[model samples]
Target: MPLPLHHLRAGIIGTGFIAPVHIEALKRLGVQVTAISGSTKGTQALAEQWGTPEVYGDYDYQSLINSPNVDVVHITSPNRVHVEQSLAALAAGKHVVCEKPLGMTTEETAKVVAAAAASDRVFAVNYLCRFYPAILQMRAMVQRGELGRIIHVQGHFFQDWLLKDTDYNWRVLSSEGGKLRAVGDIGTHWIDAVSFILGARAKSVFATLETFHKTRYRPTGEVQTFTSQSDPASMVPYEVDTEDFGSVLLKFGQADHGHVSGTHANCAISQVAAGWKCSLYVGIYGTKGSVQWEFQQPNEIQAGYRDQPNQVLTRNTAGFDKDVANFTDNPGGHAEGFPDGHKMHYRAVYEHIASGKSTPVLYATADDGHYEVKLCEAILRSSEKQTWVGV
Candidate 1:
């Protein structure tokens, strides 16, 4: 297991935007955050501000992994550093929770998985959405035959953050984010969710991806971003080697039966449209009725049928499903959001270590990361050759 919660000393690597999210989750779990590491001065300052002792700004990554105070490594580094850092931490005999899309590419991701499998340590990917209360409820609903037999699933995930010409990150670059940015970064989460929820593997897909904003702005003065999120006028063109919007025409084979009736069908994921803020929209069509869920609204479940009135199922209330209803910890009126999902994820991870629960089977692992990377490659191949590529 993961040394008892009281004894677990966690250290975070890379203090970018998501680092704080990890720290906050650990706080809720009552785990200690002993140290933090980053390659940037601003990140080091943020770590100090957060009261993490023994801060390491320019320290060697391997030394940080080998630190005597650390019992687990919660990796929040960039895509490129995920594998190397994870391998180092795992080799140092620390349990690891690496961020999603486990590594820069499938080859690298598999190496991390191989290392984890070779060790006795607990290794997992942080695809936190699966632990969302609503999603948990939906998984239970599908299992209980509330939806009859899943027929078709239509998923859409989009955000307007990159809609502006000035928005840029290493993610927009191919070497950093790989050949497919949208499909790799966020799309894999959707794919992992569908596989876990519907319990199906994609058989094949036909895809089309593009970089609509071919040229982006660069900072005229010293700015935070490598290119620029400001200084729109003094912008320079950066070749977008990666695609911004990824449209995958998916076909999933028979995997889970009797929950939802999808004899054989499709779903899609798009990240560069507009106005979507980290939403996981699922439309499950079944024989008797259909259920819909959007991650943004985690407290309620939408259900519809031919003979009866459509209803909204709220948590801890009469309108909810039996499986998920059992885990409701709140009464009516309190609110839960994305961070709650992370909490649920951490709870599962903790339970796996503490109680030896089999839920770890459902959590994302490095192999999923490997397959997701291969899937992205297949998507690119299918898009280029105008043919279906099998996963």
Candidate 2:
């Protein structure tokens, strides 16, 4: 039995870039954000700005988790604190929704997984890209054997945010970010989304990671991601320890249900791609047919068959799976992008909590997030050793 939800009140523990996203998604589901806890510099400003009444500072995170007003906790803090914070929330008997890369390493993630198993709490990881309508359609096609034995998968997650040497963030430093930046940050999404769509897990990984800029300009003032500041005097040069780009060769094992066996694929992930911006392009090739979906073109999927011409499937159409159709918020021609994906993901989370049952569609859980951390560890090992590492 699943945990029953009432009121769906959330206590958010971080006020970083992703906090508003979580707030907006939860609001879409009519979930109340009862409290907000920010860094040491925290104030009532964020809470007031978001219309959440209660505000807690860094030291009072426990107060937020233990607050009776908060039925759930959203851990949106940095990666280093995820395990401790999530475990605390679970121990307090509160359901939790955590931001991605659930932990900095596999061991850290496993600790949370163990805690989640021992507790009767709803735990979710924000792999919101899985909620895309086209992604759901692709998964259904592969699941129903419409794609026929999936032989290969290919994709890349590219963004130009860190293309310039002036780009800097907490993500560029190893002390704050983990040793693998690009791979841990965006590569996890590519790996998770591809594995989810294909219904397969990576068995082995062979990879390489590159840190292009040895030093980057760190801004003395606050700067948001993907935005650049050019004042040389206001920025200081800092050495980079994490990778900016990575490529991984993946050999996928047989699915748990014995489908998609022995498939192989490759993914190229980068934060320094010159012109591409948030282009997550994925294609799955099967013996009978092939399917392609790109994040930039979120509303449609391109399908090709051995015996017929290529076809395009759009949202809200009879040709798509019923689940896919249901996920599509607008008519056939209306396009839904990243924000919609987050909303649908939150919808699934709230619905599951409300019904006390898991749905047919996938929403990333502690276990799924743990598996991704394992994959990231393998990728890091493969990159360091220059040898294939088993996942």
Candidate 3:
């Protein structure tokens, strides 16, 4: 029997765009969001907005972690502090659902892996792309040999939020985000989702990265992601160190399922692609057939076959089987996109915690998160050296 998710109380650290996403998703799952910690400017307002009782301002996440009211901690802070906050949350015996890329470096992320391994708590990385029903259905098909002997995968994650020289966010800086901006921020979602569907990990990577805007302007004060500041007088110019766009080629290793081994995959990731907003596309081709999905059109997938006519499989319909039904809430024709993915992801995590870790581990673990960071480092090296680097 499954336990009630309402019993788990969550505390969130960070007041950025993704923080409210975490809060709203937890609420939808009947989980109480008791505490919120972040900058003094936004923490109290955010708490009041959600009627949360405890507010830890000035980025004081330690207090939030120590609070008896919080059973789980959601680390949505910037990339640099993920490790410190995660370690603190673990030591406090709090279950954690941290935002991705784990940390800035593999060395620091390894500590989180070790810490999570030593603890009995449930730790998850917010790679919520795995929760999409289409992705889940595709994984089921691959595992069942419906898509026989996976051949190659192709996709791209593109956005125009950072297209202009004046458009700025903390992610544009290597110091605030990681060394790789577009890849680390969104590209990993593509890679992780593909890995989940294929039941394999990328063994090596060949990447080419480019920074389109050599110099970009930012406002004197910090602004939330996707927020616009158009006045040139209020901005100052700085040299951009991170890539605005990149193309990556990956060679995946064997999966436990006999269908896939040594598969080839390529992806294009960009934050500067004009008019495209949060578009993530994935196509997996196999000997038997192929499945294609786009984030913009989350409700259906295009399944291609050589011998027969291709079909469009919509969620909660005939082609989507019982395996993916649990991940989706709405019926056929009702559109569920980005926010629903977050909700389902949190539902899976909270259920695992509520059920005493008896539920299937569908969410990304600490080790998976660590591997992504390591892969990001390898991608950076590969881009610089113009050669394939082993992950």
Candidate 4:
């Protein structure tokens, strides 16, 4: 319980696909994932596969939290369990790093924000997209007025994982995923990224949400993400309560400076474009120039100006700003993709926690996660009422 949290012991609370990513990132930061909690199906195997020293049943997550072997808890479970488990860990004086939509609703998130504020333990939210080197560069440009007078922002987070009617997952069920699927799962990332870059919060949102296939077939057996069983004989169709797609129009708060029309800037977000897989595209248009970044091109940014030729700014360019270039892990040609984003994010968290210092702006804290929930609630309200709602 002190400074220099290097070699910290971590307890992970889920064995889903996201858990492995967290494990890998923690490993890169010299953290030991000493324990894990999971369902009976694969708990042992997952522990063995990852070389975790101990395992707990899903119901025993609290026991894992109380164990002396764990110093931190990483909650990667379904939406319904995040707030409860995180509260437990905070109450136990353990630091926490929970997945996005930290709480399913604004009310739940408020409780988490309050609890974290009252405690001395570190709390982080996983909004990994912000850690990309290209994204850091974009933020620097906006901060330096390199993209003078920000005018508009637009982005989309698309995936083909649920494109087929046979796709099935807990996310489609409101009981597990909350009232929103597409917006909560992926749209938050899009919203968080642009907000982080522009240094603004969404003031209002006009939105529409839709579920293309009201029902989908679930295979009788287990299945992984992005892969679905197509056999009708073994698949059973069930009604889906959450949306598969969402589009939102957003108005942002005014920045201190560098805004074209003060609070008049707007943004649009999408999660259901066909044929696109895990694509997160964000662009900011300003009076002087414009810049765009895509997850597919994580190492480069497309920038254009009114009178000059457009340039693609790759990471680690010699003439680039030093602060932005520091985010680059290697020379210009070496690419840093999704996994690297996770690593950089965890590194920031590790550095802050290890130093026993105040939380840095570079890491997404519970407060930031709560604001994202506020925006999500407004989006849902607007979609239902067919009018703009304050965020």
TM-score of each: 0.91, 0.95, 0.99, 0.94
> What ordering of candidates by TM-score runs from best to worst?
3, 2, 4, 1
Over 1-391, each residue of candidate 1 has an lDDT whose tens digit, in order, gives: 3335655678888776778888888877777888888775845786667788767777456667888998778898778788889999998998888887787667788788789889877787998877766677777667777777777777777766677777777677777667888888878777777767776667788888777878876444333322237557666766667777767777776665555332444445555567776677777777788778787787877888999999887766775645554234567567677776776676666656655545445567777777777788888999898889887
Residue pairs whose backbone atoms clash in candidate 2: none
lDDT by residue for model 2 over 140-161, one digit each (tens)? Answer: 8888888888889999999998
Candidate 4 structure lDDT: 0.82
- Stretches off by above 4 angstroms in model 1 are 1-4, 220-228, 256-268, 319-322, 325-328, 356-360
Top candidate by TM-score:
3
For model 4, where is the 10-residue window of minimal lDDT?
260-269
In terms of lDDT, which candidate is strongest? 3
Q: Tens digit of lDDT per residue, candidate 4, span 1-391?
A: 3235456899989878898899988887678889988786667778888899888975579988999999889999888989999999999999999998798888898999999999998899999998998888788788888888888887778887887778788787889888978888888898888888888888988899988888788876656555667777788889988888877888888766555333343343333466788898898998889999999888888998989999988788854537554345678788779888998888777777777766465978999999998888888999999998998
lDDT per model vs. reference: 0.73, 0.85, 0.95, 0.82
Scored against the true structure, residue 299 in model 1 reaches a CA lDDT of: 80
